[model samples]
Target: MINKKDIKTLIVKKPLTLDCGRVISDFPIAYETYGKLNERKDNAILIFHALTGDQFVTGKNPVTDKDGWWAYAVGSGKAINTDKYFLICANVIGGCMGSFGPSHIDPETKKAFGTKFPVITINDMVNAQVNLLDHFKINQLFSVIGGSMGGMQVLQFVSNFPDKAKTAIPIACTSSHSAQNIAFNELGRQSIMADSDWKEGNYQNQNLNPGKGLSVARMAAHITYLSKKGLENKFGRKLQERDDLKFGFDADFQIESYLRHQGSVFVDRFDANSYLYITRAMDYFDLPRKFGGNLSKAFEKTKTKFFIISFTSDWLYPTQENKDIVIALNSIGADVGFAEIESDKGHDSFLLDVPDFLNVLKNFVDKSYEELIR
Candidate 1:
């Protein structure tokens, strides 16, 4: 079992009020760092992880023994080159990766928080993570970057602290969660809740693993991360093991087996209740609504350079939604750049090894660094 002691964390002693009107302090924000912080501290980049991602962004996760989630795009000489930049990624407060979450014991009852854990929002996540800046003594970050829910955190981070970052990159995400997004997330949550092993989110106390339900949730959500064309190109109608149909529901197709493997492995590393909490946070994200229904207002008084990206095939957070952010920034006469890269991969294009994306991202960050410092 992965324990909190295995991960590095920052214990936040100062109380932080959440959007849900709860105050929490002395909680932990689990994190990992790469590269060295420069004397000026301007090279620091705060990276935010997507829904299931942890603080392990660019190296082998000590706990999972698996490649870090952003291994392809980050590392010594990759796009977000650690050779020239210092990177810090925090496991969001609602995460399971040794961060403050439902799995942690509540001092009052001396039991796991479970469903009693207060509901968090995208705003709450960024608010808690911003403590990292103070902890690291960084007055301003060189950039704030993330994709999907991470991207939402990036938006909230910049909005909440306009002057804290010099540049902001929100990729393959939306300022507002759509109804379709909520529906898909709800499906995953319901699948988990439906499992008897879930035990009403108190399964941790009972020592019953809600693996089946969490696996199903992961499987359902995984489908939304891929595109129709990408799925067809990769799996199509290929058989898993035997070409002949067994007629039973035993994963006859390659896609079924692939999804099953994805789901099963996910439960080994993730907590079921954390999944529920994080999805609710994602579903509640509405940046424009928070800013008086004018997304442009979210960028007011911020000189942070903005570079937004989207994948043409990402129906989950479509290019149009990304364009909406660009349109809003443009309306406010904010300095902004936008790109919609062509890819067969869906919302997951940002995470995969897309050369076009890697190059574009590298060029933007590097060029911005040089120009800013000059």
Candidate 2:
């Protein structure tokens, strides 16, 4: 069980109006910090978490007792190098981890808000997070960075607060969620809702955990994170435990077993309602469309240095979508740099230990710091 007291929180007394025209105040924003903030405070980097990620960015997650999601890329002497920078990661509003979400008891009804939680947008998410800057007294961040949904937050952050970050990195993500991506998210949502145990998202009140439904949703979404080549190379036609196909739809292949494990473990850490809400927020994201169909205009006012990354095998966001961001920044003459990394790890590549990705990222931050000091 996650002990809420173990998590750090900021209760924003300021009311926030959501995209759905709902106003919430005094809500908790759970976060974790790493390293020490120097006297200059300019060494701070605010990292946004992806859909399934929490405030745990590096080291051991207190709640899960597992390696943080970006453990391979962050820490002392790693890419982000906490030894030389202050890192802050916050659980997004609609997240399960000690943050304000549907799982929280509604003050009015004294029951879990469940689906009654106001629908949030990527815009609302970033706006709420910007309060962290005020909390930390950081005038400007050294950089704002993240991958996938996190990457979308990076873009929205820069667009919403043009002068708040010195540099930005949006990795393996799209400015707008693609139709295919929306369809995939919908499949996950439907899988969860289809389970009878869900009880219209009120399972918590009835002591019923819709684990089966949530597990299937996770299994479906997990497949989208990997490439066909990656899956074949890793799991192939290998049998799970038997040599022959005594298969009656019973874990015949290693791939099936692997996916089952992923789904099972995911349900232990995630909430079903959160999965639905966050994916909906992602599906609703369309930065270009929000800015009157001109992507360039979104960043026209910001001078933040951009370093966008995309993997060769990431069909979810794809190299083209990442490049579209680059093209838009370039059209307005924004300081932007891009790299199309050669990898078969699909959309999940950015979270893994890809040497080329790590090296370029490290150099950019270190060199950018040198430039900042100079």
Each prediction's TM-score versus the true structure: 0.99, 0.99
Model 1, stretches more than 4 Å misplaced?
Answer: none
Choose the strongest candidate by lDDT.
1
> Which residue pairs of candidate 1 clash?
none
| Whole-model lDDT per candidate | 0.94, 0.93
Tell me each candidate's RMSD, in Å, in order. 0.8, 0.8
Worst 10 residues of 2 by lDDT: 365-374
* Shift in Å, residue 190, candidate 1: 0.4
The clash count of every prediction, one per candidate, is 0, 0
Tens-digit lDDT track for model 1 on 232-255? 999999999896999998999999
